[model samples]
Target: MSAFPLALPDDAELSARLSARIGQHWHRLLAALRPLYGEGAWEGELAARLLGAAIARPADLRALDQVREAAPDWFQKPEMVGYCTYIDRFGGTLAGTRARLDELSQLGVRYFHPLPLLKPREGDSDGGFAVADFRQVDPKLGSIDDLRALASDLRARGISLCLDIVCNHTADTHDWALAAKAGDAKYRDFYHVVEAADQVAAYEAHLGQVFPQTAPGNFTFVPEMQGHVWTTFYPFQWDLNYANPVVFIEMMDVLLYLANQGAEVFRLDSAPFLWKRAGSDCRGLPETHQVVRAWRAALAIVAPAVALKAEAIVGLAEVLPFLGEPEQPECHLAYNNTAMTALWAALATGDTRPLSTCLTQALAKPAGAGWLTYVRCHDDIIWGALKGVIPDETLARISDFYAGAVPGSFADGQAFQAEPGAVRSTNGMAASLAGVRDGADNAAALARLRLLYGVTFALDGIPAIYMGDERALTNDPDYAVEPDHDDGRWLHRPRMDWTRNGGPTHAAIARFAQLRQGRACLHAGNPARPLLTADPALLAFERADRGGDRLICLGWFKGDAMTTDLSGLLGSGDWIDLLDGTDVNAQSVAMAPWGLRWLVKKNG
Candidate 1:
């Protein structure tokens, strides 16, 4: 079954230039699918369906496409700042979220990521990730129309709305899953189903557990279907079989449908697990990139303003493929997961080697691509992304420290599924890990938290601040006891205390916002170069653009004050500290415990 050299028909609604853009990328899509599915009947049918979607794209969205076509690098510009939160937590509902635009405007948040607002399974929805319906918004959040209204209002204020699109799986109660259970031949092919124990055992040899504490393995037996279904994350979440062309067309339609509702960025969740093959790790596969690029092409044909953000929380080497080489662009933005996990590792060990290594890796991103960097996100912190940067034994120690297994470890984090032979993930808020919950680290937790956020702000990528981190919101210890919510990730996902926030952290954020305005050095095009420091506890980096504007960022990971030689990273110039107005002489600068420094070249 060869699926290459397929004809993707032109859409009548598309302008000649837009149709030509489709013509340019359609072959790349065919080239990707041919090796995976072959140039057979499936290719022609999928091409027709994709063209139909392009034609059916809303007129309003096509207008947006034209506007953004004029400003191609809008999202990549320096002023982009993101905030990720859940609607039920950030606001009571979509209407409430709309009412809070003043707050987002006050914080200068141009990119808003409302985490997983889509409808999910009735019970234990994996924090809304096990999507039951792609087009509907969660009733607890708001209606679909409310989401559209909120998105419109956000766009008017120069903010881009981001939503999560789960690509790998759907809830067991999803229409397709239900149809498959009812013996619908077409729907059954949408998911991976193994008939025999032997088949499951064969795949088990190569499969790794995503949630060992609860889900255990990759396959779950469904008696009604009379076969074992592939459930990568949970038994309720069935992994979609991407090898099937029908599944591809249906999901591509869902993407365009949501774009018409005003989503400017789609966070491609679980992107690494999209394409599965036997005798392999079944992650970050070549087919996976093809599907992403194809989706990118489809969006370009319909709504060019929207961007895809890959959530491949894997090792740096594995993540490189997701951000395709500059010429063949895949995701416009991807998560800086290595630096996120390495930040915790560095804090646990007070050694900047792994953190510095992660920074060095991120500094080498493709020209047109940028990362979504944050202190921590809604999920657990897995140690896999930091594998090569830190030794295995040391990583285990850091894990133990965050998991509360090590003595004097002040972080009140819970380890998820640390079975004797299983890889563990961790859960805890940044504030709790920084000792804010119990006032550990001599009551300097707030300062320590500020230091981390400062580093995140000073970095070259789009800095995203999670809901709780800005206010020093501590962990919710009650999550472990909550019914149907034993997942450790809820520890970090606490409800927003909107009234009590905007303290020192917010003040620090305001200062970073002030410095970022009109300063082209903060743009994503500038790579964050890791700066070597004489002190092992200080992590520093230099972010400078081609235009010669430079900013040097320094973070003290240690609990005690330290003075270090700044000559290595600092150039010959009168540098002004942007964070604080302290004047430092040529070669030496002293930092307070858990302090942060931002030094800019006196004048460009």
Candidate 2:
């Protein structure tokens, strides 16, 4: 079989345009897919159909094309700051969210991630991951018009809207699932349904459990249909079968439908586990990449401004493949999972070794690709997958250290997935993790808060701050009692404590962010090797662009007053500290605990 092309019928102009752009690298993409899809003539024909179908909506397609032509570097801007929150959690509804544009702008946030507000099943919706309908917003949030109005308001404020696309599965209550249960043969092909338990057992031999605490197995037996259904995350989320071409068309249609609604970015949730095979791990399969690439090609012809961001939190090696190259590039952006984990490890152990080591070995992205740096979102922090780098012994010690299980532990976190012999995830607000909640010495807590924020601001790519983190909101006490928020993650997802604006912890965070804003020269600079210092507690690096503008960012991991020589990275010059406007020698300098300094060389 020859590899399929992205060619839809009745789209001659789009076909010609795509053919010109993809002509040189078409054969290479086809060769990679031949082994999995089979070398048949139907491959090219199917590809043409998908491509032609992409441009069926001429008006939406043209608008996207215009964006690509005008601002290709919209994502690479140095001013990018992301804020993630649920629509209802932030304001009250979609229209209410639109009412709060000024609040987002106050924090320098230009990228917004509102978690799945789509219509989902009434019970145990897996935090809206078990999607019932892809196109409609949940009535609890607002109407479709409300979403469009919010998107328009955000766009006018120079902000980008990023919504979720649950790629791997849909809720068992979805139309396809309901139709399949109704004994419709066409809909039955949409999902992987096994008549006998043994077929499920065969795949279970290699499949991994996503929620071992809540839903242990990979397959769930639904008595209503008398068959075993594949559900990796939860019992209600049924995995789709990509073996059928119609599934591809249906999902692609959904993707285009959302782009037309003015979503500039898409969060590709649980993307790695999309394609499955027997006797294999079924996660991050080669077919998964093929599917991602095909989507990329289709989107390129239709909505070029919209970029796909993969939410793969696995090992660094597996994550890099999702950020495809010039021709077959998969995701334009990916969560910096390795870096995110590294931050937590450093915070608990008070050492920067693991953080530096992992970043050094992590893969580099293509020209247009970037990382989305975040400290904490509305999710639990799982360290099991980082076993080797974050040793199991170290993790156990850090766990107690963060939960105040150990003497002098600053954090007051809750335990999640705490089964015996199973490494657990951590849940707590940034303020608690930074030592503000447990009544540490006032100066000590303030110092720790600044240090943590300092590192987050200096990290590579766009820095994203969780809602209420800027105010240093403490853990919510009522989530455990609330029926809707029984999960541990809710402890970290506290409401905005508007009264805490000028409190010591909040001031420390706001000042830290202010410092970051002053040094856009470093955050926006090109990727460069970090200059290592002898002290394990010190994290230092110099960011320089091609034009020779350089900025040095140094932070002390442990909140301790110490002095260190910086001549190695400072290039033997007198530099001005942007924070205090004091001239200092780059040869030897003293910094306070958890203290940060932004320095620029003084040109004579």
Candidate 3:
């Protein structure tokens, strides 16, 4: 039984030297940093020491100079819109991405998340999640100079570049893994390699299988190494052992190294699984929180401007803990997984009961922390884990409903990762989920699209649009033919079709986006969880100034002949409906099937 060392050795003299180095660079800012990190914290002191070491090294010093002048609260903004796309999918490479800055700016996008551009092991790189070399870019995605130039261009346009720092695991072909396989004792200490099957069995007993269809075990047998290597996601991607303090220091070096590369925000992929313990699920362990806390402490001390965004794709209960207290920080922003899943589920069921429940129970985000809300992303939709709160039978029905298996269902989606017992994840574009792909050119499809977009825009976090979703791009049937995109996610990850720009659907999208863009109520404003005045058929909420002005959004989840009267919520007045150019009385406001009315009180 090898107990992992959790702390570093004595370095008080080294701390003083590092503090002086930082003081020399940032004399004025040290006053603000001292209060946040405390007088003498290990993480704070270590970050300065690491910064000093980085400056002495033969790498570029320009990033360090920029760090000294970086803004403290650059992430906090009302109009911050995010755009996530693969460099190859959006452009072709790093330089190609530089060419599209003007287009991204047209969408009012201030933050860009280019998915995993780092070097990966050739055959199975888990879509670049399995990082081979943390220090360099994928040769396929141009050089470090291209990335530096792109970052400079993005910064000039007020767009922050967000990159993935895959903290969970590294590719099997990484130098450290290769060394460990060749009987290098020092390298073996870098990862969790077990000689005994009993230890491996203990971990597997409590651990949840990530990709149960493909990778079955928590630990994989690496024959070349003649040992069991911990592989949480896949056999080729070995998990790094954080029990060793050196691993912490080393990964921190990787983090700051990238931050210096002009990365304003780091999307910490699979962050919840950083630490593992026996007799536990080995996810979101106490040590995991501590490690993240240590990283937060380090960032506050050195890079006050750079923010840590967590990618924890867990249940609603486990999500809020990532956003720690303002004084002692964890992550600046977290993916709104519960709300995202709920939105899909709501659309399928044609009832906002689940959506309302999620909003009421699970939407209490911390003051300083923000939520990155989106309809879809590059990952598979994880369904069953939240089954404890939402029943398995309900989840199965929802899955079937979206897959077009259930009769009279509007959604035209394909199921991914379908297990033996009817458990599955759904994949489709926003338009497909709205039933527009089912050859409908009528008002029903348009109404459904509006219903989806209205809920998306009215949600409590930052709204994100999947690249061409604004123009009602349906699922691409040909993506399944390609080997790399065979995993049904490509059903939604289609190329931007500018040819359809002149169509009626495109005009509809433009109108919706115009409404979305004009709403000051939806942008960073706290909307009260809509108290359902009507039946489960209608969902309504109010984003109020709380006293002076109010913005009310009402939508009918289903039914062709349903009506909701909101005279109780809105006392009296003729309001302007942003969806249609009509002044309607609040006393008898009626909406069509799948119709949404965003009413804002008008002043004389």
Give the winner by lDDT: 1
Question: Of models 1 and 2, which has the larger TM-score?
Answer: 1
Tens digits of lDDT, candidate 2, 1-604? 2333443345587656566545543555455455555666645554555455455545644665677758765665666778888787778899988887777777777789998888988777877888999999999999888988888889888788899999889999999999988888898888887878888888888877777787788888887667888888888999998877667667877787787787888898999998888899898988898888877766665667788889887777788889877766888788877777777778777778777776665537676677777788787777764667878888888777777788878787877774448577788887777777534455676667666666666665677778777777778878767655676778887766556654664454445445555344544436534668888777776666666767777777776688777777677768987666788787778888777786778762
> Which has the higher lDDT value, candidate number 2 or candidate number 3?
2
Sort by TM-score, top down from the best? 1, 2, 3
Best-to-worst lDDT order: 1, 2, 3
lDDT of 1: 0.83
Alpha-carbon lDDT of model 3: 0.71
Q: Which ten residues in a row have the lowest lDDT in candidate 2?
A: 1-10
lDDT of 1 by residue, 1-604 (tens): 2332434446454647555766676677666667777767776676666666666666776778888989887777778888888888887899999998887777778999999989999988999999999999999888999999999999899899999999999999999999999999999999999999998999988877777767788999999789999998999999999999888878988898898889999999999999989998798888899889888877876678899999988888888788788667899999988888888887888888788888887766897888888898898888866766777787778888987899988677877665445347688888888777644442587887888788888887789988867778888878767667777788888888877756787788767766887778888888888888777788888888787888888888888886766775686767778888878654877889888888887755
lDDT of 1 at 356: 85
2 or 3, greater by TM-score: 2
Off by over 4 Å in 1: 1-14, 40-48, 55-60, 418-423, 438-443, 480-482
**Candidate 2, residue 61: CA error in Å?**
7.5
Alpha-carbon RMSD, each predicted model? 2.6, 3.4, 6.0
Candidate that would win on TM-score: 1
User: lDDT (CA) for every model shown?
Assistant: 0.83, 0.74, 0.71
Q: Candidate 3 has what TM-score?
A: 0.86
